[model samples]
Target chain A: MIVAFLCQNCAQGAANTAGVQRMRYSDEIHIVRVPCAGRAGAREILHAFNNGAEAVAVIGCCFGACHFSDANLITLRRVKIVKKFLVEMGYSTDCVTMYTSRAAEGDTIVGDFEDILERKYDPETPPCPGGAK
Target chain B: MVRLSVVQLRGCERCAWDLLTLAKNSSVEFVSHPLIDGGSGSDNDADFVVITGYARKSDEARLRELLSRGKKLILYGTCPYTGGIFGLMNQKGADVVPVTEYLSPVASVLGCAPSPDELLSVIEGQSAQRQPLCSECERHFTDEEFDKIIRVPDWSNREKCFNNLGLACSGVLSARCAQRCIDFDTPCRGCVGMVDDPPGRMIGYFGSLAVNLQVDTVATDCATDRLGDRPDEITRSLVDVVGTFFRFHLASHFKFPGRNPSTGDELADIMVARPIEEAPQIAATIYGRYGISVALNLIEAYEAAAGIQVSDETRELRSELRAAQDGLLTALDQHDIEALEGVIDKIRTIGGNEVLSNVYFGGFKRPVKSAKNGFDTYCVGPLEIKAVHARSEDGCSRVSFSTDEQGVIREWSCELRSA
Candidate 1:
């Protein structure tokens, strides 16, 4: 299952807009609202993985468009650090990703969710033993 | 009246003289050689002990004796604080000791030789905060002027910011140098020392300037040229990133990966094969030293450049690298010189020896040649190594090496020299 932490102002708004538009995204994907994407710490992301999150995504405001000054940049770095740590722990690094979106880009959010699912379960490489899933 | 005693360990007595001159001009009582009133005072009597220079073994007894006096110790110069120019001795396996190893100083006045005014201020119990050099600089460039910057400018006589002229000016990374070098149309070499900032913020500040000026190519070229020749983009990037960012503060900064232990060869091995368990400690150290903002900026830059995302096999390879380094460190600790070869071979298999040599051996065009006699030789920059010799001195081993060019030979050793 894919777990996404979305910023309330931009990413969550986009998800809400997608819902109103009746866009089709993977039902396996679940969304959690966060005050800002920067609020998602590495420990929380690791916790999601520990609790059976197959893939993790953090969506925030587009670069330079963050409502809070450079909060999205913080989100980017935190995600990267978690991804690196996950890789070191013998897990797939690509299972964790960061995305940026505008409130109006509902279609992009749906597409990104689908893409993460496909990439996480690529048939060429077998699932890592004792992987997050 | 507070008594101050200045002791010269091994560096030039310029700072001591400066302090004496300032004391003479002030109401403060300073005691040193050639006393104005023809009177000498014992160091034990002084309220504060200002020590200058890299502490050698001969100075150990004296230092111990002085420390026994129970007076407040102030490491008064760069040498005592950070080993100063003598820090280069670390590359040669010298045992130059900073005052911090003995005991924590009340204050550290860091400069090649701190100005008498700064010394006086420290003596007066004033805290010195490093301010950004840009705040003191008068030069300002418009967008158009910044856009015109190239790696090598045609006009050297132009009066403008050296950075705008494509020079590798470290003003952005440094504390104020009063624009002394920049005014003379020379690039700032960060001689005064780095401001207390993470290297990442400095990189971001420079990178943003490059992007805004549309001179990323120029900036990259300047960095590449400064780092000498290396073929791989990642290697070149690593060198460029470190060279540009950690120019002055390499010895002091925690994030650079080679500051602690001062073992270049082993550090190269450890950096290339960073252990999974050590990542948190490394991250914490970087964050603790440079703060959150700077740490984040650096992480972004490093991830973007290095493509840290790895596959399962690569992860295993990194683990092997970690084991190899741990073995090497263990061997060094146990004095098992014979086991180092095997450990180095394992590291080479995991992370190519060529990459290791290029990164730590100063980017030599050829592989490092082990001497038939005993010394290991490698080219460092433009200089060709003729020979290296290791000798024992006062319970410590000192490595001495010579570089030759056009029949002229110059020698350098880890041995501390007299002022």
Candidate 2:
């Protein structure tokens, strides 16, 4: 399963908009609404992978939209650490990613999920638990 | 006679020689020295087994055999204890490991090369009181005086403290080891791994410092306020503080390492063999917790020491930062800014009230007072805290709180402007 950590304000709201608009995406993604993108950090990211998350996405508010002053930047930095660790320790870098978006853009979130899921069907890589539905 | 055996792992054999040359007692019997008498690895008869150098994948069998012997294992230097210089191979995938994970030792006599007398003291059981290396030759300075500190200093003045000179002396951050470097006028490189996480402490401390320092001194437009800004700097500075921090620029300002050389396919395929749980721990042991993958760039380093993940248990302040992080990620991640901010405020209240109580006004009952005119001061450990507020006829009111420890107004304190 893909564990999607969505910031409740922007990213989660974007996901909510997709839900409200009935925008369809892959069923593999399990949206976890966190207060902000930075809430899901190293431990949480690793924990998701350990619990069988084929991939994890941390989506935060767009730049300057974060009320706490650039917390998305903080999330971006942490995502770097976890991603570096995944690669250096011989884990797939494809398993993790980060993004910033607005609440009105439901289609963008759906598009991101589609792009992520299409990789499962990509000829370059082997198929895993997060299969192409 | 105490049977002493030496196991040379991966470092230069100076620590072993220091033990032998410094031993004046006739009561200790030398049973095996791999370089000298050359006994095999599985000797259980020795009362004291000294292991020097960091462990490598090739040395696993011998290390496990020696550890399995149930003898008193003494980690003889920085390499064995903190993975030493040879551990730099970790990012390269050579698989260097610290002896700390192998077994607890009778004593960890750590240093790049400890003075000859240290081994003698450990054998004699003449244990000295444990304290920070800074306390041995510390020179105190107030908050403002500290900012004037520079990287390099006049070599002539050996009496002065390196930290006071603004030299990033590892002594201040390290535990009381053999004061070998301190006495020799070369500041203490972190030969002994600190009891607390070194990289986190260094970045956090320097982050706070970078905040108070003039922006132009460190950088132009970029501001990296978080702790782990330079992954390469953290790894390089592990045991050699002087090379990375002091005598050079702040370690944060040091260049990040060139990208690690691992192919994405090679990474994905390897996980089939190594479990996910071991990945974090092994990486942590390698540098995740040790050197840490700090700031990706100079801008990120100053942007948010808050940007990096800090899990240091020793400091109460970091705990608050950790608490605030959840609310921040929530606050910053989404569009409902006001509600998420409320979550952050509530967390600060819980954290602040845990430490602060009874808001003792301290004899200031005026119409209102600015922070500078009527401030109350108190001490927490080595830090001195100052706070100010205005009170009504009933008592002190109007308290503002946030998790910014650096802000003139934070936690229990407020930037009480004139009312």
Candidate 3:
């Protein structure tokens, strides 16, 4: 049940709002904030798995928006690249995913938590159980 | 005053300036002795002999003769320390076919021309031996002088392996100190000897370059000046650290970074900040519809038309384009570029009458105007056709075409031709 958070600028701020509101989230979800979806890379995603993360999600600004200008597009590209590496490394490729949100998307944040936690996760990855190989 | 002597044999004189700066307030002397004449008449009584430049057997013999007189010598510059530019001759199979094989090691080079400071340091009994600064665990002994808590080693090695560490001499003990080599913008040549074998903390000391500027030019410049192939080793070491990033950075500045264009600039440009607004998606859509080559072409076209070289502020954007290009190409290659035939046909059908040529090809030519003049040119020969690659949004298929005439290379639904 390893969990990780990929926070978009808005989503992250919303998470802070959630914290202020005392909204509940699992303690297992380790948050790693990125400037934009575009900054994520395959090496980083794999490094997460190598370092004992079982599930990872990328949160980005709303579909049409980004922080550094065109970062959403960069994020999509990185997601695709990371997905390709995930498939190649023979991990449950779906273990890594991406979502978009706005700073005010508190409801969307709750929905994302439900979706990620309920999704079927494979634990048979080579680096799973323990990172020892 | 500190007495100094300068000699030039086979080396760039930059070390001479460095040595002079170090000895500016001290008394100094200079000499010029080609590897011939047994290098006689040099002052034997001086506090130190600052040996600069290249040295051969003749210089080695003369230096040995000088040392026989019980005088101190300093092998100045990288030339004496690691054979400098002359190390190129040591490349394997580099010997002339007609001559006997000859390859000189760094030890041999230094044995020939000792630096002035090194000579003085050794002669003044300052270099008697490296005090055991570490215990058997290869850790330095350190404790708070203020508190003075007794923290002594519990174990000791009955056998001394410092000899087994393969260190050249105590003089190289300084190599263990975070190589100041980068201080001079030069990568450590390991002339201080191999780091891994020597179990010590002072050695393998990771230190940042004094100057924040990248040291890409150091590899090439030092190699060219040292007249040796040692620079190749330095470059190899750099690659291990930064991968293709170093080559691209240097090449971006020098106009010739490396052998592969796709891997070089294509991967290097992605380190920039990508704005999360509508830009990335719009960029993706534009990129998805037009393909990576088209995007790069547009970026290149925009830069060329603007007649301004990419500024540092916009470099990250360029890097993003490159990173995208690399990702798309790698994805396409894995899936086979031509598999996108159906998508290409569908895109073509969808855009029947629209301008499919989202990509534009500006004629490539030598520079007619510099960036200062607001006129820049992409070097394109009259006969060379620009290659175009197109791929679908899902990255499943891609196809490439090129016309003998001028045009931009990228993915698109429509065809373009020179006016």
- lDDT (CA) per prediction: 0.47, 0.46, 0.34
For model 2, how does the per-residue alpha-carbon lDDT over B100-183 read when each residue is reduced to its tens digit?
A: 666778887766555546665777787634567766663443353244434334544555666555555566577676433454
Q: How do the residues B205-250 of candidate 1 rate in per-residue lDDT, one tens digit apiece?
A: 4333343221111111111101111122222122223333333333
In terms of TM-score, how similar is model 1 to the real structure?
0.41
Query: How would you encode candidate 3's per-residue C-alpha lDDT over B310-341 as one tens digit per residue?
Result: 44323333344344445434433343333333
Tell me each candidate's TM-score.
Answer: 0.41, 0.46, 0.26
In angstroms, the error of model 3 at A25 is 1.7
1 or 3, which is superior by DockQ? 1
Predicted complex 2: CAPRI docking category: incorrect
True contacts kept of 1: 0.00
- For candidate 3, give the docking quality class from DockQ: incorrect
DockQ of candidate 3 is 0.01
* Alpha carbon lDDT at B393, candidate 1: 24
Docking class of 1: incorrect
* RMSD, one per candidate, in order: 18.5, 23.1, 26.6
Cα RMSD for predicted model 2? 23.1
Q: Residue B199 of model 3: what lDDT?
A: 12
Worst 10 residues of 2 chain A by lDDT: A124-133
